[model samples]
Target: MLLHIQFSPEPIPAALPALSLGSETGAFVEFRGFVRGEEGDHTIGGLVYETYQPMAEREITRIAEALVVDHPVQAVRILHRLGPVPVGEAAICLGVAARHRAEAFAFLASFMDRLKKDVPIWKTDTLPAA
Candidate 1:
Protein backbone atom coordinates (compact mmCIF):
# COMPACT_ATOMS: atom_id res chain seq x y z
CA MET A 1 0.00 0.00 0.00
CA LEU A 2 1.56 3.26 -1.15
CA LEU A 3 0.27 6.49 0.34
CA HIS A 4 1.51 10.07 0.12
CA ILE A 5 -0.08 13.22 1.51
CA GLN A 6 1.54 16.63 1.31
CA PHE A 7 0.64 20.29 1.82
CA SER A 8 2.73 22.22 -0.66
CA PRO A 9 3.01 25.91 -1.34
CA GLU A 10 4.07 25.09 -4.84
CA PRO A 11 1.86 23.68 -7.54
CA ILE A 12 0.84 20.07 -7.57
CA PRO A 13 3.41 18.02 -9.45
CA ALA A 14 2.44 16.67 -12.84
CA ALA A 15 4.11 13.37 -12.22
CA LEU A 16 2.77 11.98 -8.98
CA PRO A 17 1.19 8.52 -8.66
CA ALA A 18 2.96 7.67 -11.90
CA LEU A 19 5.98 6.78 -9.84
CA SER A 20 3.91 4.93 -7.27
CA LEU A 21 2.46 2.50 -9.76
CA GLY A 22 2.99 -1.14 -8.91
CA SER A 23 3.24 -4.25 -11.10
CA GLU A 24 -0.37 -5.15 -10.41
CA THR A 25 -1.63 -1.73 -11.31
CA GLY A 26 -3.68 -1.77 -14.46
CA ALA A 27 -5.70 1.43 -14.14
CA PHE A 28 -4.77 4.93 -13.04
CA VAL A 29 -7.00 7.95 -12.44
CA GLU A 30 -5.96 11.44 -11.53
CA PHE A 31 -8.34 14.16 -10.38
CA ARG A 32 -7.42 17.83 -10.06
CA GLY A 33 -9.44 20.65 -8.48
CA PHE A 34 -8.63 24.11 -9.74
CA VAL A 35 -9.44 27.59 -8.60
CA ARG A 36 -12.30 28.59 -10.80
CA GLY A 37 -12.99 32.06 -12.15
CA GLU A 38 -16.31 32.25 -10.38
CA GLU A 39 -17.86 31.06 -7.17
CA GLY A 40 -21.64 31.42 -7.19
CA ASP A 41 -22.40 35.08 -7.87
CA HIS A 42 -18.92 36.21 -6.95
CA THR A 43 -16.17 36.62 -9.44
CA ILE A 44 -13.07 35.02 -7.99
CA GLY A 45 -9.50 35.99 -8.67
CA GLY A 46 -7.78 33.28 -6.65
CA LEU A 47 -7.80 31.60 -3.28
CA VAL A 48 -5.73 31.58 -0.13
CA TYR A 49 -5.52 28.32 1.72
CA GLU A 50 -4.46 27.84 5.33
CA THR A 51 -4.17 24.63 7.24
CA TYR A 52 -2.99 23.19 10.50
CA GLN A 53 -0.36 21.10 8.81
CA PRO A 54 -0.05 18.34 11.36
CA MET A 55 -3.75 17.79 11.84
CA ALA A 56 -4.70 18.32 8.21
CA GLU A 57 -2.08 15.88 7.03
CA ARG A 58 -3.27 13.32 9.51
CA GLU A 59 -6.87 13.66 8.41
CA ILE A 60 -5.92 13.41 4.77
CA THR A 61 -3.87 10.33 5.54
CA ARG A 62 -6.83 8.75 7.24
CA ILE A 63 -8.98 9.40 4.18
CA ALA A 64 -6.36 7.84 1.93
CA GLU A 65 -5.92 4.87 4.19
CA ALA A 66 -9.63 4.26 4.18
CA LEU A 67 -9.66 4.44 0.41
CA VAL A 68 -7.01 1.77 0.10
CA VAL A 69 -8.76 -0.51 2.52
CA ASP A 70 -12.28 0.02 1.18
CA HIS A 71 -11.32 -0.23 -2.47
CA PRO A 72 -9.13 -2.44 -4.54
CA VAL A 73 -6.38 0.06 -5.08
CA GLN A 74 -2.66 -0.32 -5.56
CA ALA A 75 -1.65 3.16 -4.47
CA VAL A 76 -3.01 6.62 -3.56
CA ARG A 77 -1.31 10.01 -3.79
CA ILE A 78 -2.93 13.19 -2.53
CA LEU A 79 -1.48 16.71 -2.78
CA HIS A 80 -3.02 20.01 -1.71
CA ARG A 81 -1.65 23.51 -2.28
CA LEU A 82 -1.25 26.00 0.50
CA GLY A 83 -0.96 29.83 0.37
CA PRO A 84 -2.29 31.54 -2.73
CA VAL A 85 -3.54 29.68 -5.75
CA PRO A 86 -4.44 31.68 -8.83
CA VAL A 87 -7.58 31.09 -10.80
CA GLY A 88 -7.23 28.10 -13.11
CA GLU A 89 -4.37 26.77 -10.99
CA ALA A 90 -4.82 23.39 -9.49
CA ALA A 91 -5.48 23.40 -5.76
CA ILE A 92 -5.73 19.70 -5.22
CA CYS A 93 -4.65 16.56 -7.02
CA LEU A 94 -5.62 12.98 -6.24
CA GLY A 95 -4.19 9.97 -8.00
CA VAL A 96 -5.27 6.39 -7.61
CA ALA A 97 -3.98 3.16 -9.09
CA ALA A 98 -6.00 0.00 -9.27
CA ARG A 99 -6.41 -3.23 -11.19
CA HIS A 100 -9.48 -1.96 -13.05
CA ARG A 101 -10.64 1.39 -14.34
CA ALA A 102 -13.99 1.28 -12.56
CA GLU A 103 -12.45 1.04 -9.13
CA ALA A 104 -9.90 3.68 -9.91
CA PHE A 105 -12.55 6.07 -11.17
CA ALA A 106 -14.88 5.44 -8.29
CA PHE A 107 -12.14 5.74 -5.71
CA LEU A 108 -10.74 8.92 -7.21
CA ALA A 109 -14.10 10.67 -7.22
CA SER A 110 -15.06 9.47 -3.77
CA PHE A 111 -11.68 10.38 -2.34
CA MET A 112 -11.88 13.89 -3.72
CA ASP A 113 -15.34 14.42 -2.22
CA ARG A 114 -14.16 13.13 1.14
CA LEU A 115 -11.03 15.28 1.08
CA LYS A 116 -13.00 18.47 0.53
CA LYS A 117 -15.45 17.80 3.31
CA ASP A 118 -13.29 16.03 5.88
CA VAL A 119 -9.85 17.64 5.51
CA PRO A 120 -8.96 20.41 7.92
CA ILE A 121 -7.70 22.66 5.13
CA TRP A 122 -9.56 25.92 4.65
CA LYS A 123 -9.70 28.22 1.64
CA THR A 124 -10.52 31.90 1.42
CA ASP A 125 -11.90 32.98 -1.90
CA THR A 126 -10.49 36.17 -3.38
CA LEU A 127 -12.84 38.41 -5.26
CA PRO A 128 -11.85 39.92 -8.54
CA ALA A 129 -10.70 43.51 -8.73
CA ALA A 130 -13.45 46.04 -9.22
Candidate 2:
Protein backbone atom coordinates (compact mmCIF):
# COMPACT_ATOMS: atom_id res chain seq x y z
CA MET A 1 0.00 0.00 0.00
CA LEU A 2 1.22 3.49 -0.86
CA LEU A 3 1.12 5.95 2.02
CA HIS A 4 0.83 9.71 2.36
CA ILE A 5 3.69 11.75 3.78
CA GLN A 6 2.19 13.76 6.59
CA PHE A 7 2.65 14.62 10.22
CA SER A 8 0.41 13.42 13.05
CA PRO A 9 0.14 14.32 16.72
CA GLU A 10 -1.32 10.95 17.68
CA PRO A 11 0.84 8.29 19.24
CA ILE A 12 1.65 5.27 17.10
CA PRO A 13 1.32 1.86 18.67
CA ALA A 14 4.05 -0.77 18.81
CA ALA A 15 1.87 -3.21 16.99
CA LEU A 16 -0.80 -2.29 14.44
CA PRO A 17 -3.42 -5.01 14.63
CA ALA A 18 -5.33 -3.39 11.81
CA LEU A 19 -2.59 -4.38 9.41
CA SER A 20 -3.13 -8.08 8.78
CA LEU A 21 -3.43 -10.58 6.01
CA GLY A 22 -5.90 -13.35 5.22
CA SER A 23 -5.53 -17.12 5.56
CA GLU A 24 -4.60 -17.36 1.92
CA THR A 25 -1.35 -15.71 2.83
CA GLY A 26 0.74 -18.35 4.55
CA ALA A 27 2.91 -15.86 6.36
CA PHE A 28 2.67 -12.33 7.64
CA VAL A 29 5.61 -10.25 8.77
CA GLU A 30 5.45 -6.94 10.57
CA PHE A 31 8.21 -4.51 11.57
CA ARG A 32 7.75 -1.57 13.91
CA GLY A 33 10.38 1.05 14.85
CA PHE A 34 10.10 2.91 18.11
CA VAL A 35 11.54 6.19 19.34
CA ARG A 36 14.54 5.59 21.60
CA GLY A 37 14.70 7.49 24.83
CA GLU A 38 18.37 8.27 24.50
CA GLU A 39 20.84 8.92 21.75
CA GLY A 40 24.57 9.06 22.49
CA ASP A 41 24.00 10.13 26.14
CA HIS A 42 21.54 12.83 25.12
CA THR A 43 18.07 12.39 26.55
CA ILE A 44 15.63 12.31 23.74
CA GLY A 45 12.51 14.32 24.43
CA GLY A 46 11.12 13.57 21.00
CA LEU A 47 11.97 13.20 17.34
CA VAL A 48 11.24 15.41 14.39
CA TYR A 49 11.06 13.63 11.07
CA GLU A 50 11.00 15.23 7.64
CA THR A 51 10.63 13.73 4.22
CA TYR A 52 10.91 14.93 0.68
CA GLN A 53 7.32 14.02 -0.09
CA PRO A 54 7.50 13.21 -3.76
CA MET A 55 10.82 11.41 -3.70
CA ALA A 56 10.16 9.65 -0.43
CA GLU A 57 6.85 8.26 -1.59
CA ARG A 58 8.30 7.24 -4.91
CA GLU A 59 11.24 5.42 -3.34
CA ILE A 60 9.02 3.59 -0.87
CA THR A 61 6.66 2.48 -3.61
CA ARG A 62 9.56 1.25 -5.65
CA ILE A 63 10.92 -0.78 -2.75
CA ALA A 64 7.56 -2.41 -2.13
CA GLU A 65 7.22 -3.29 -5.78
CA ALA A 66 10.72 -4.72 -5.86
CA LEU A 67 10.02 -6.88 -2.81
CA VAL A 68 6.99 -8.34 -4.58
CA VAL A 69 9.11 -9.17 -7.60
CA ASP A 70 12.05 -10.64 -5.67
CA HIS A 71 10.12 -12.40 -2.92
CA PRO A 72 6.81 -14.16 -2.60
CA VAL A 73 5.17 -11.18 -0.96
CA GLN A 74 1.51 -10.98 -1.82
CA ALA A 75 0.72 -7.67 -0.21
CA VAL A 76 2.77 -5.02 1.55
CA ARG A 77 2.05 -1.93 3.56
CA ILE A 78 4.59 0.69 4.62
CA LEU A 79 3.58 3.40 7.08
CA HIS A 80 5.81 6.12 8.52
CA ARG A 81 4.97 8.77 11.07
CA LEU A 82 6.19 12.33 10.64
CA GLY A 83 6.63 15.36 12.91
CA PRO A 84 7.09 15.06 16.64
CA VAL A 85 7.17 11.51 17.99
CA PRO A 86 7.86 10.57 21.57
CA VAL A 87 9.83 7.70 23.04
CA GLY A 88 8.39 4.17 22.78
CA GLU A 89 5.99 5.35 20.07
CA ALA A 90 6.19 3.79 16.68
CA ALA A 91 8.10 5.68 14.02
CA ILE A 92 7.47 3.26 11.22
CA CYS A 93 5.48 0.12 10.49
CA LEU A 94 5.97 -2.35 7.68
CA GLY A 95 3.75 -5.35 6.95
CA VAL A 96 4.42 -8.09 4.47
CA ALA A 97 2.30 -11.04 3.38
CA ALA A 98 3.89 -13.95 1.64
CA ARG A 99 3.52 -17.63 0.80
CA HIS A 100 6.19 -18.74 3.28
CA ARG A 101 7.37 -17.64 6.67
CA ALA A 102 11.03 -17.45 5.72
CA GLU A 103 10.47 -15.23 2.74
CA ALA A 104 8.16 -12.95 4.68
CA PHE A 105 10.69 -12.57 7.47
CA ALA A 106 13.66 -11.92 5.18
CA PHE A 107 11.81 -9.51 2.95
CA LEU A 108 10.47 -7.56 5.90
CA ALA A 109 13.98 -7.12 7.31
CA SER A 110 15.45 -6.14 3.99
CA PHE A 111 12.64 -3.70 3.35
CA MET A 112 13.27 -1.83 6.57
CA ASP A 113 17.03 -1.77 6.02
CA ARG A 114 16.71 -0.53 2.49
CA LEU A 115 14.05 2.02 3.36
CA LYS A 116 16.23 3.52 6.07
CA LYS A 117 19.28 3.82 3.84
CA ASP A 118 17.58 4.71 0.57
CA VAL A 119 14.37 6.61 1.34
CA PRO A 120 14.51 10.41 1.35
CA ILE A 121 13.68 10.76 5.02
CA TRP A 122 15.68 12.57 7.70
CA LYS A 123 15.24 12.78 11.46
CA THR A 124 16.34 15.28 14.09
CA ASP A 125 16.23 14.62 17.78
CA THR A 126 14.82 17.00 20.38
CA LEU A 127 16.98 16.59 23.42
CA PRO A 128 15.81 17.25 26.92
CA ALA A 129 17.51 19.65 29.33
CA ALA A 130 20.85 18.38 30.56
Quote model 2's TM-score: 0.83
| TM-score of every model versus the real structure | 0.87, 0.83
Q: Which candidate leads the pack in TM-score? A: 1
Off by over 4 Å in 1: 14-20, 125-127
Estimate, for each residue in 23-114, the C-alpha lDDT of model 1 and write its tens digit: 77788888888888877778878888989889888887787778766677887777889998888889988777788888888888878788
Please report the TM-score between candidate 1 and the true structure: 0.87
**Pairs clashing in candidate 1?**
none
Clashing pairs in 2: none
